[model samples]
Target: MSQDLFKEINHAVLDLQGAQLQTYERPLKRLVSLLQHPDLETYNAELTEGLDLETFLEESARTGGSMVGSQRLLWPDSAEECLGLTFLLLQKMGEDPAYAATFAHDFYYSGSKIIAGIHSLTGQLIIPFIRDYKSYTQSKGSALVALQDVRSRKVFIVHGHDEGAREMVARFLEKIDFEPVILHEQANQGRTVIEKVEKHGDVGFAVVLLTPDDEGSVKGGNLQTRPRQNVLLELGYFIGRLSRDRVCTLKRGELEIPSDFAGVVWEDMDAAGGWKQSLARELNAAGYSIDWNVVMR
Candidate 1:
């Protein structure tokens, strides 16, 4: 499986290398299709597990990195910080390439922030990543993922272009005395989208709105509705970070839901305002102090 997988990857990357910047979409689409294999991602997660912070710090002690400012410490940089992000973006693109323009996401940026510009992702991030990944794929790396247990009162609201639904959820959370954190409303402080998500990982719960803002499908398949790729990207992130119990996806309108998340909780974002009660129930189940009066009102 590994041999066949990388063979496909090698072929894809070889093609990507020969294509011009404007012609990248075809090779990228092929590569995105390859990423849907569960074995490939399982193998990837195993190889990169050691890069997690907890294990990185403790394991670094042997290399004289116990001190904060030690030269041997693995410091943050563009490639290191964007590793997980690029993978997530790839996952989203794989799910629906037609909507991938939101996530084909301009491959790499050299500066402190990932700026909007023309850069060949194939030449930059993918080529280097595959080179490094292949070198390490044969070896298994382990890491201790320290689960964040601090129950926060702040709820992160992940939304798309549905401003009405976004405002409705935010206001309802506020009405119940729960602080709603919206990414667009948050202060940037010059941080990129993914960077802001990394720092704000302490949210107690995530309310993701799967609104139909884009449409896509495979060749010959019917054009189906779906949320923005960024919404799906963040939805996957929160599900992994906070676990299923701490996350709820409010699907608005008729859209495609990822098959992988068939078991995860999902509520219909109806026009009659029934989703508020569903959210309040989820909040209470997660040990939040929810007042029926506020929820009823």
Candidate 2:
């Protein structure tokens, strides 16, 4: 089973109390029923015959203990503690499955002492984490789903060192009303990374920079080889998963397209005004609605 799903369900359950308990009753019962079904015997396990709830409630207090009131928090930072709680819950269910069904409905009523012992014995982190699939489905909306079903629209750009290329891409995107998540902007650390991975890992195209040639080095003079290498790897991943046509390769000067991408359609960008007009025209032809005037503006 997915460990993450176990953690999520566990953390949510540990927060049960008063109104929270009341709110989760139906779901809890359903979960209990799923876990207790005799035929689905793989998940059967129990760390303790009766959970030590008191110590768990005490450790979960707002002021002390390793987790320190994580059970009661919500969102952002709460997501981690929620993971910990889920971890413990799964552990308990795995210790012994026989008693699982009998305690399903009664787990909520178990006092703090019983909860604490269970938490302690089960490492205070194990959980039968189950993911809520509907949450992700609803957030993206049906339009995205429809778009995914139709002709798969993807974006690919040849990255150039000319700072104008970045600005040009941004401007053209605005004109087309297309919000392309640029790699430079999304490569940051922390929560930003996670969000980017979740949202744009499947982007259809890339904006690559083309540099003027130089004979002195392996990369030549203007060839920004490193960035292209990274983009190529990304393209390969996309092409392997999606299709070759999804990647739109563009360039600035007389640089030869990489042997791997030689067959991809290439467009020339104006050195004087950057690639604004040329890119807009090409993207528009590809069925992406792009406003040349707005991009120029």
lDDT of 1 by residue, 129-245 (tens): 555555444443322222222246789999999999999999999999889999987789999998898788678789999999999998999999989989988989988776665
Residues 111-164, candidate 2: write the lDDT tens digits.
Answer: 233332232222211221233222222333221221121122345343435566
Off by over 4 Å in 2: 1-161, 187-199, 212-227, 272-278, 291-297
Q: Enumerate clash totals for all models, in the order shown.
A: 0, 60
Deviation of model 2 at 65, angstroms: 81
Q: What is the TM-score of each candidate against the true structure?
A: 0.49, 0.37
lDDT of each: 0.65, 0.41
Runs with alpha carbons beyond 4 Å of true place in candidate 1: 1-150
- Candidate RMSDs in order: 19.6, 21.4
Q: How accurate is candidate 1 locally (lDDT)?
A: 0.65
